[model samples]
Target chain A: MSRRRPSTRTVLLAGLAVTVVLAGVVSFYASGHPDGLEYVAHSLGFGDSAGPHVSDNSPLSGYGVKGVHNARLSGGLAGIIGVLLVGALATALLYAVRRRAPRD
Target chain B: MHVPDGFLTAQTSLATAAVAAVGVGIALRGARRELDDRTAPLAGLVAVFVFAAQMLNFPVGAGTSGHLLGGALAAVLVGPFTATLCISVVLLVQAIAFADGGLTALGTNVTLMALVGVWVGYGMFRVARAVLPKRTASVPIAAAFGAALSVPAAAATFALLFAAGGAVPIATGKLLTAMVGWHVLIGLGEAAITFLAVGAIVATRPDLVYGAQDLRPDHADLEIRDGVVV
Candidate 1:
């Protein structure tokens, strides 16, 4: 029997599905500790130098909805939204920059 | 690493911003060649995956966590130029939507993660691939090596930028050591992720993996007998 490789559409959709699960569900279990730079900064006595982000008041600030009280839902929704946004932006950018089709 | 605002002075931020701008401009041009009919969809998928993977910050040690920088993974999945653009898009979305990285520090973040991470990772991967056995199996191993070093390279670049325009006067040496040390641990995670991701993609769809393109089965099937055409 011939081994049939998955089509590009199938692979892309599968990859997207995996991304949704990772961002929406698995992200909830991520560690809450400071990352490498943040930890090192505080350890070295410069952590306080960080200024508040200008977008701190945005709805998606801190990776959660502004009014959403449920931590899990908020973070999951935010993650999924972020995934979509990244996908949209990246696809658009690639379309603009990628080589044009001959028929066009 | 996300370099927040107030960490570096305005001058430093502006300088880095200029650098990021130029780097991204060049990447835009280069990506035009790397991205075409077949790879554009894959590139978008990579961008989204990087955004998602970045959210899952696994702990390294001592209460410090590390997430996927995704330079090597992206470089292996897509080409280096497209990888840089993909990461820049992820950073742009994160800053605007999630307010994760500071607006003023956007340039620094792009410089460190997008430019430095992608180039250094791709460069290292090329070096490792050249030395390792020329086979599809070597792609993931080279990608892992590239991923492992990319994290600390980004960290060290941050340290250099901080020393140049840090808001507070701290021991640069100590900061560098700490940053590199922690990132070394994080790089291990990066290596693991790159290894698994690249290995899976290479195993399933070797044609789609940019890094493994040269090691395609047809290339290995070449029989140049007596330096003459078969």
Candidate 2:
């Protein structure tokens, strides 16, 4: 293979590959502890004030799919779905709003 | 920080939503100027990457964890306008599908992480880049500096929002202290991550990095001595 710099397409594909692995596989091993804001809320005595999420019953709630008993698979499925959904929406919005070719 | 619903009053949530709407509208216009065919795809990838990274929460001592906010990294890779949109999209996906953040509080989350996080991080990056030496290497360093502070700055803004429209009657000062204190630790991790990501990309594709565009060495810098750069 030539030692020339890889094209931008290669770079983006590489990045997407890493992103998929992180979201779909590695995420299952992340810490289960509360995030900084949640910790602060609990410690500061407002923890109980938080209401239930409106989408708590979503099929992919809490990053896990319903009825997917295998913990890893459930989380991984949910994550991949989210990745696709977010990627599609973000890409569409950005593409639509991208600068058009200048009028001659 | 992804704020849960019910922590803030309905009125406050609505107000923040309005603010987020305005911020996003302006960003939409600004992003048009920033996004050409080349960079628009990168901006979308940034949102996807942030969504992925946020799923990997690192422990920050005391049984608490923090995840990547990604605003600084996004702003460094794409311009701030696109960075804001990127984060907003991630937050929206999380809210609707993952049930992570609240739907009612979506605007609040957007305001904090999208608007405040992106602008503050980008602003700090510019300030740091100006103070640091004018070298391509300094871009990631400056971005890291910005990442370090952006977390706490967003947290602090959340604290102020709580004070304004919090459902509970808590002492604002103590809440601010707690928010800032914990987030400061989180910010350190943010700095390290931002430095690595930005540095890696900047090293490989310096031309694609928005923040380093100015610092990139011009072709005019080359001095040809019989067709060999002196």
Candidate 3:
């Protein structure tokens, strides 16, 4: 008998669910501590060497929305927007590459 | 680690940016060979998933936190070349949209996370798989080891770059030791996430996993017997 496989739709949907939960809901609870690099920089006294970001004025700077006051809501909105934007860009790039790939 | 602007001398950043450009050009060609109609969308999803995952910073210790770089995870899910593209996309979005990384430092971040991290992790995965038994279980095990090593490897790469042209003068030895030490701890988190994610995917949809593709035939047969192939 032929074996069945999980449909692409199912797998994609599952992935979407995980991404939504992690980026949209759970991201607010992430630790606020400096990451490994930033921690090292601060400890080593070179943290001051870092310059200002070019996009410092971006509405979504620092992963939080500019106008939103509620920390959770701002972060969650920014994360969701990031996921969607990245998802769309990656999909377009991959599909474009696939279209150009050699047919075999 | 995302290196911000002015962290490295302009000369070093420019040189690394050139290298990053060449690497990304190669990756674009390689990804074309790897992506297909079906897998292409999955690759996109992998990028999305990685971006989402990176938002959650899990604390390591001593006021230090780390997030998933997702290089190994993406390499195992998709092929390495596509993994490079996935991470490059993430970094691009983070830098441009979120302003999380420096715009001028985009190339450095891509080189460290996308190129070095993915290649080292994928290479280690290949080596571990070769030495280990040719079973489905070996996939996640090898991936865990690969993911674990990749973090420090990237940290070391950064150390080398800093040594070459850090904006500020610091002891290279001290930086290397500190970076490698902290990153080793971060590597544990990388391994755990890679192992769990790969294991979960292999359990439900092994065929979708690029690194586990070799074991698909046997896995499919076993799933058929268990009445869970679907």
Candidate 4:
């Protein structure tokens, strides 16, 4: 069979839909604790040994907007923002990579 | 796992960077040929989905949470070449934009998550497809196993990296045991999510699944047989 080619619009739309749905699912299902790596580091006694994050000074630290009172909402919104930003940025980068090829 | 800046020694970071650079270079070259219209956009979508999925961390024992790694998921959704590029984009975005991972350690992160994770997970899936029943349902099972195994494999990779370049004093055995042990449970979560995601995709758009080549029959024989065509 000839290769099936999904349009750029279709791909982007599908990606957006998947992002929103997965974000919602994960936000609802996510646990209220540190992750495995954090736990391992803690259990191994290097939890405190973690050097300060260079981005600690950034406005949104630890994937949460500063000054947000609601913990769950803050984190959930942060997750959404992260998804959108990462998706957009990656698409743009890849588009550039595909577009800016020297003539063969 | 997203290794931080100061987590590993300079030597370790440099070595991992070299490996990642080579892997990405290979992926880029391969992608030029493999990523056509359908795969190209689908690859981008997979990256977004992986990014979103990784954000949702499920709780493990002792209140520890784990999220989807997406190496296997990407590989199964797109081909391995595009999968590596997709995941590498996610990691790059995470490191640069969100600072989720360390900037200096981008090479290590990509090497572990993109190359190693994709190969192990996709390799297992390929083996499973050949040995297991030839059915659409089996796709999810294979995906589950692939996704589950990928996590601990990644943890093991990290443990190895730590062993070589670990700055903090810790027993390698304990580290390995702990990393692998926790990741095993984490892998279960990954499997469930991958199974569900891949299943949903296959159900809605079988055409989108690159890994479904084994399941698709020459003639459209849509039957519900366990060992037969799915």
Report the C-alpha lDDT of model 4 over B1-230, residue by residue, as the tens digit: 78778778888899999999999888877766556545566677788888878777787878888888998888888778778888888888677656677877889899889998888888988888887888777787888889889889989999889888887878999999999999999999989988987887776566568889655533444665887755
Q: Could you give me the TM-score of model 1 versus the true structure?
A: 0.95
Per-residue lDDT of model 4, residues A1-104, tens digit only:
24354545764587677687666445656675778877888889876645666677655556666787787777667667777776676666556445344558
Tens digit of per-residue lDDT, candidate 1, span B73-107: 99889999999999999999999888888788999
The DockQ value obtained for model 4 is 0.36
The residue ranges of model 1 lying beyond 4 angstroms of the native Cα positions read B218-230
- Per-residue lDDT over A1-104 for candidate 3, one digit per residue giving the tens place of the 0 to 100 score: 26565788988889889998899899999989999999998899899999999988989889999999999999999999999999988988888777454568
Clashing pairs in 4: B136-B230
Each candidate: what lDDT?
0.92, 0.92, 0.89, 0.78
Q: Considering summed lDDT, which 10 consecutive residues are worst modelled in model 1 chain B?
A: B214-223
Candidate achieving higher TM-score, 2 or 4: 2
In the range B1-230, model 3's lDDT, one tens digit per residue, is 88889889998989889988999899999988788887998898899999998998999989999988889889998999999999999999999988888888999999999999999999999999899998778888899999999999999999899999998888999999999999999889999988998887777777788998877545425545466564
Fnat for every candidate: 0.90, 0.85, 0.80, 0.44
Candidate 2 regions off by >4 Å?
A: A1-3, A102-104, B218-230
DockQ of each: 0.73, 0.68, 0.69, 0.36
* Backbone collisions counted per model: 0, 0, 0, 1
Candidate that would win on DockQ: 1
